[model samples]
Target: MKSSYFTTLIQLLLLGAKNPIKLSTSDLAISIDKTQQTASMHLLFLEKNNMIARYKIDGDDVIQISASGLKYLLSVNQKIQSAFDDNSSTLVTGKVFSGLGEGAYYISLSGYKKQFISKLGYEPYPGTLNLKLSSNLHKQFIENLSNVDGIIIEGFTDKKRTYGNVICYPSIIDSNIQGSVILIERTHHDSSVVELISPTFLRKKLKLKDGDEVKVNISV
Candidate 1:
């Protein structure tokens, strides 16, 4: 059945229209925010599709969501939950590394700093935490993330040069510290190297140093 019909069925279920409970078309109309005629039509459609069983118990109309209807709802719920699980969190394992000292300079720029604060909900510290992927699998994951659209920090120009836009993925460091994995349009690093930015100094906060392993949990 169409999704609209499923929605109407869900509304009916919510109104206690299950297990052969008494339900009126007028009551269903108010519950579904539709006219009585529309509600009656939905009921007919559902009954025709074998999604609902309608009958009269002692001359009063009664309705019940059938086994097939319950099965359909369960299937829809499972699909939604699976999608949520897939997108909710992605773990990327890497080892900490020192950058070329360019991250501090570019992050300190007012043009990028302001947008980082406004869009990312935090003013990043004047530096970024660099990570080298632990394996080819992790590197491939980061490479895939680079292609997807993320929270964009628009590029700007000054008297010196024009800066390229930065794409940011909201992330959690080691499951506690909040940060972002940023992909820059212009960078000295390759896809295997992930650059992270946060409100505080990640190295100091996490007591991390060069070659220290860390996991970044990115929300896609």
Candidate 2:
């Protein structure tokens, strides 16, 4: 989507949000600093795309954004936030935990492993090391990270099933081991649990066990 479209949609949502009643095109134009004709054109496009609804109330054309419009606006806000998050790093603490044995099956898949090798510059171990965030501050970092774009490992289809996309951020574990915070698109784990994969066996090398505290520094 063009940045201009998002700008207009955001302005519209803001104006509509102030009141439950729909907004007049002239009022929207004034709020967004655009001419009425230009605002009407933008609103028409939004309505056509199902982002907003237009109706005649009291013989006047009024508009309000739809639920989809709000979602798109939120996505735009995230993109703006991500633009400012570049090159910044976040340190988060977590406790080691055993996974449900699904990570190995997906990580071992030829399609996924090949890309992980090519993109990450290493062939990851056939399984992931799972960690549960120990603090709410660290958990907020996860939410912020999800709003931004990370290095993506594209998914591919096999004869059996189609694999989903994966997102990765360069990370330093326990201030020593270099790896990534690997986010699988399709996962049985909850948001509080993070998965990592490295060339080395993290459990043995780091002397980690269930309930052991570890710190991961993720590159934003």
**Number of clashes in every candidate structure?**
0, 0
Worst 10 residues of 2 by lDDT: 13-22
Pairing residues by index, what is the TM-score of model 1? 0.67
List CA RMSD, all candidates. Answer: 8.2, 13.1
Query: Could you tell me every candidate's TM-score relative to the true structure?
Result: 0.67, 0.60
Worst 10 residues of 1 by lDDT: 12-21
Off by over 4 Å in 2: 1-87
Error of 2 at 155 (Å): 1.3
Query: Alpha carbon lDDT of residue 153, candidate 1?
Result: 96
In angstroms, how far off is 79's CA in candidate 1?
5.3
lDDT of 1 by residue, 1-220 (tens): 7766788999877877667789889988888888999899999999998889999989989999999888887898899999899867788988998888999999999999999999999999999999999789878888888777799999999999999999999999988998999999999788799999999899999999999999999988
Root mean square deviation (Cα) for candidate 2: 13.1
**TM-score, structure 2 vs. true:** 0.60
lDDT of model number 1: 0.90
lDDT of each: 0.90, 0.83
